[model samples]
Target: MKTKNRILQTALELFNEKGINEVTLRGIALNVGMSQGNLNYHFRTKSEIVSELYYNLVEEMDEAMKKITLDQPVFSLLYESSLVSMNILYKYKFIAQDLHSVLESNSELKVHYLALQKMRKQQFLFLFQNMIAEDLMRKEELKNEYERLYERMNILGDNWINSANLFFQERSSKVAHYHSLLFEVIFPYLTQKGKEQYLKSL
Candidate 1:
């Protein structure tokens, strides 16, 4: 692998095992068997590396979402997307916590986070529209219901992401628990046929 890619992979692994704040440039260099200066040559600051990592992760998610067949049932699409997202979080929980911390502390990261939120909102909107078009939703009133639900989900997602710090510290299972709970709350609102299909798939 290229030095840059190697550094990123190593950093991600380390960050996953240890919280972002605990992983230093020297720690990364030590693990990768590179000099601090060499690491610095590739990434000027920790935040820069983090920014790149976040961008790469989002790109991976976007690519994965694109590969899902739109012809699939809406619940299937949602379940697949949720699994992908949860896998990413479970794999890189520390880096995610670090990114959230940096975003909280830095204005530039906040701007990036806001942009990310917009993209996520658009993606959810598209998914919701596809489900509605498929006649999977129970009520026509659900068009507005989903809009409200999307807002709530966004808030909940943010809370869950930020709450990673506390969850990790407490060694709690809140992340997986909350995700399952949220999905259950939304899944029952589907049409009777849709619910049967979803439950059968599960």
Candidate 2:
């Protein structure tokens, strides 16, 4: 691997092993077997490495989203996407480990994340429209109901990793447990047909 990529990977490993607050650029350089000055050429600060990793995480998630096609049942697509998302998040688990602080300390990343959230909300709205048209979801009957649900989902998505790190003693079950909670957020909005198809797809 190239020096830059190696630094990012090593930084990710260290960040996961030790929380972001504890891991320093010097520590990462040591693990990468490079002098601190050499590492500084690629990333001057720990936050710089973190910012790069955050963008990497977003690119990976965008790739995952691209895998969704119209050929499958919407419910199945959701299930597969949720599972894939969970796996990706787990792979880059440290980003979400100190999510609030990471974003707060970096204005540019916080802005980017907010924009992504807006885009994701539109995507969810589009998906809901499609699901409703296909008899997979009920039309929204309450004011801003789906909107509220999306907010709930956003909260869960943002925090679930940290929550899992704290609550789940075993690493293996963390992704699976949080994944189910995420998918179930939409359950009440599913029509009978949607429920049947969802269960069948599972």
Top candidate by lDDT:
2
CA RMSD of all predictions? 3.6, 1.4
- Candidate 1 residues lying further than 4 Å off, grouped into runs, are 129-135, 140-145, 158-179
lDDT of the structure predicted as candidate 2: 0.89
Enumerate residue pairs that collide in model 1: none
Give me the displacement of residue 13 in model 1, in angstroms.
Answer: 1.9
In Å, residue 115's CA in model 1 sits off its true spot by: 2.2
Q: What residue pairs are clashing in model 2?
A: none
Q: Across residues 1-202, which tens digit of lDDT does each residue of candidate 1 receive?
A: 9999999999988887776888899999999999999999999888887777777777787787788787766667677777667666655566455655868867776897788888878887777676667766665464478768778886665456556555555433665665665566677567777778778655
Please provide TM-scores, in order, for all candidate models, with all chains considered together.
0.78, 0.94
